[model samples]
Target: MKDKLKKLIIIPAYNESECIEKTIENIQKNAKDFDYIIINDCSTDNTREICERNGFHIINLPVNLGIGGAVQTGYIYGIRCGYDMAVQVDGDGQHDAAFLQKMAECLEETGADMVIGSRFIEKQGFQSTGARRIGIRFFTWLIRLMTGKTVTDPTSGLRMVNRKVMAKFAKDYPKDYPEPETAVTVLHCGMKIKEIPVVMKERAGGVSSISMQKSVYYMVKVSMAIIIERMRRRK
Candidate 1:
């Protein structure tokens, strides 16, 4: 069943010139079965040049759309290209390409609409700092309370969605602080969500976009988004 599925890997890259090549090389070496595209989110760096030099397929946005917008662009492409499933992998080389096939297989076996590759499921790999972990746990509890769903890694970017949800996301995905809010949206839409344990590495290169100053803002913004989404009608 997995062999018959049309899978695509969406790498949402923003100023990842240092790590983008390694990320694509890993995918080419490990996950050759899936087609891939890099969504270059109008990086101020030489990210676009690097992709063009390597002759990799990419969708270069004119303006800097946030992570959510970049990922939605990939979803739009996947749907238009007749893909059955789309898996998101970070361009910072944090997510392992080797686990992509496992995620797809888990989706097939469980019949879930989405599968999240989680770090806390087995508590392995780069668990981050205590402050960040505390924030993640807060969202984890909030999701369970609001949606009656337990997501150990609600902030995880490594996710795979079936075509049904992919089409919806392509039309109206969250613009900022999206990952956690999207999880709530999936529950509101009555889509099945599953989390599988997977190890994650620290970013291979470049600083993380979410700085200490922005972390607080990020938490409040995403938390409010998730709660507010509960009152809206599901699409």
Candidate 2:
């Protein structure tokens, strides 16, 4: 019989005190066999205190490291803990953990190095709003234009990776604006990526401060970053 994969769910959270419990509970209910660690990005709110109170596995950053840094920390921790695979699940609870098992199975059964949960493939979930979707589609086009690979939802945060790819991310990952850039980086390294349709809900709690202008600027900056990433030859 084939051995079971040891999986770790890496949840990066900042000021997610209200949503962290629900996120973990979702994972616990949906992905019962996997272990998880919460990378608390030195939240000013009572995020850390709550995690401690609930006995959640958490690593509190001494300072804020942004999304990219927090996620990289999780990959490093997962690798150190000897997990065979690591899945990125956002703490704000947008990513529905119910699809996590399907993604893991896709990775193992199809020999895919990475699998992404895309809301576009089947259009089955709370897809991004109009403005937000413009950015998602822009990155989708940019990644395909540069890499010749179609990643329909390059901005989607729910992703899974095998150990080899996990180690690569642990060594070098984009600091911010990571999702699109890392997608390009993975293809550049000749890794196989697969996408599965999954439903995504709005954040379970908290609020986003990003305005329309900020979203436009975010698109321009990440487009340039993806181009730069595509140019660099992987060592």
Candidate 3:
């Protein structure tokens, strides 16, 4: 018989000690049906220690690799471990673990390569900041222009990917502001991507890694990066 539980929840963490424990606990409570792995990205805080204490499967990077690298690491591990599906959840406590089952079911039922947990699809929670919201919308338009599909939430961290997507992302993952670029990359590779409504909450503790200045920088850099990636792929 085939494995019934073939999904792995991959949490990319960095200095998330304040919320890591709660995040894991919530996932344990809400997504007990799935296995969990936390990729501790060289957190200066006690993120790794807490993960170990809580008996979570962990992969510790020697240095901080940001969200993209940390998540890619999990994807590489997931593919290596032979998991049929992998889900990315933030350790900052914003992502809703309760949506895991819905996203996973969508992934399996629709045979989509990726299913993103979108906060904007149904407009059911505290939305992002004004500037960040504009940036997200711009990126969504860019993705649609390039991929010919309108993605409601281009930067949502809550997402589920199949083994095929894991393999592709493992081989070539983006570095900065990955979510938008990654969606385009997946579409470029002829993979189907879908979005499901998911309500998100404010982070539980500590400040966001991306500040106002960083958000501005991210918007500029990612805009240029996406255009460059498209040009390179066309060549």
Candidate 4:
């Protein structure tokens, strides 16, 4: 039965006990055909226990790996486990489980290497803070300049990647502000990428890991990193 499940949901959780259960339940209800793996990134809360108790497939990280590491771990796991595709969803409950099947279908039907769940494609939610929104727009333009495709929501955490991409990312993935940079990387590698309109909701619990002060740093740091990465690739 597990062999028949082609798509897997890779959720990276960090102190997400409050919402992880509900998120998992929703995914189970809405996307039953897909299996799920929760990468417990050294969460201080009861996230791991909750996942275990709920009979979810979980990988417990001994140390705290940030979002990028945790997600990449899931991708690696999915690739090794012979899954056809892996979709990344936030454990914070921001992502819509209902859209998983649609995204997976698009990935399979279009033969795209990556399918990004974009909030801005249809402009259907409180996307982000003012500064973050501006930052996302700027990064979107930057990614387009590099990739020759306009990605309206470059920072969206919800995305689906095929096994080929999973192999690539497992080998090398961006650590800081990975979402935007990864889209450019995938494009640079000559892989097909697509965006679909997906409605995102507000976090059901816990505060954001990215604070206002850190948001500024995130923008500048990620911009420089992307430029450097691009230049290196050119050489």
Candidate 3 local lDDT, 80-190, one digit each (tens): 888989999889899989999999889888989999999997898868889779888999898878768899899888889999999998988887678888888888778
Residue 114 accuracy (lDDT) in model 4? 97
Model 4 misplacement above 4 A: 1-5
Each prediction's RMSD over C-alphas, in Å, is: 1.4, 1.5, 1.5, 1.9
Least accurate stretch of 10 residues (summed lDDT) in model 1? 226-235
Clashes per candidate (backbone, < 3 Å): 0, 0, 0, 0
lDDT against the true structure, per candidate, is 0.92, 0.89, 0.87, 0.88
TM-score per prediction, in order, is 0.97, 0.96, 0.95, 0.95
Preferred candidate (lDDT higher): 3 or 4 = 4
The TM-score of predicted model 2 comes to 0.96
Ranking 1 against 4 by TM-score, winner: 1
lDDT winner among the candidates?
1
Runs of candidate 1 exceeding 4 Å displacement = 233-235
lDDT of 4 by residue, 72-169 (tens): 99989988889888999999999989998888888878989999999998888868778778888999889878767888899999999988999998
lDDT for predicted candidate 2 compared with the true structure: 0.89
